[model samples]
Target: MVFLLLSLVLGVLVGILLPFHIPLVWGKYFSVALLAAIDSLLGAGKAVYEDRFDFWLFVSGFITNTFLAGLLTYAGDRLGVELYLAAIITFGVRIFQDLSILRVYLFKRFSTTGPQGVSKTRPETK
Candidate 1:
């Protein structure tokens, strides 16, 4: 997970340093693919937090989700339908759900209780 996040940061930095541009004609495919990738990444994070992360599951899901999203976007374009919206909506909802799960896990992990059942927190500054 840390490696993946580092790679993402490096890729973003490279993209920013380079001046390459994707043509506007491929916007729908690009958007859907990006969203699918994010969805897969978040799913992996959620799996890791749940202590059930699997390499094969993450890889297969990442590839399949990205490819299916692009395929759907292409079909929608060819058929004159805005089918990409479905993928976008699905991915968006999933991303939020994953984030929520992660957030809850973080809160529980960090907010441990004392022997008296008092929640642990930072001491107040004088």
Candidate 2:
């Protein structure tokens, strides 16, 4: 319970802080993509193992991230920061955040598949 709450807080913090650094041109979309990658890599992997509220987890994360992003963007603008810079920063952080996830995705694709009859490949997390 504590861990889940902490994750939510962290996600919110990221969303809030992201717009301050990202450029406005592509901040929102990039942040959404970043959240998607982070959610897929961290959230989905666990969903495969834990039979719990996976649907709500993803939706909640999406909602919180977007809400925070918008709030922070508004705040940053009020603070006189360039919205474009903030958007760029958000996109940059988002891209950096997905590096490990992308690595694993690529590694899984290049490595091998599951049993001959199976179409899915399990992630090698170690």
Question: Which model scores highest in TM-score?
Answer: 1
lDDT of 2 by residue, 6-121 (tens): 99799889979885766666665565455544554455444543333377777777667655655665666678765535645664565565555555544554666734532334
lDDT of each: 0.86, 0.57
Cα lDDT tens digits for candidate 1, 33-105: 9999999999998887766789999999999999999999999989999999999999999999999977776
Q: Report the number of clashing residue pairs per model.
A: 0, 13
Candidate 1 worst ten-residue window by lDDT: 114-123
Q: Which parts of model 1 have CA positions greater than 4 angstroms off?
A: 1-6, 114-126
The TM-score that candidate 1 achieves is: 0.81
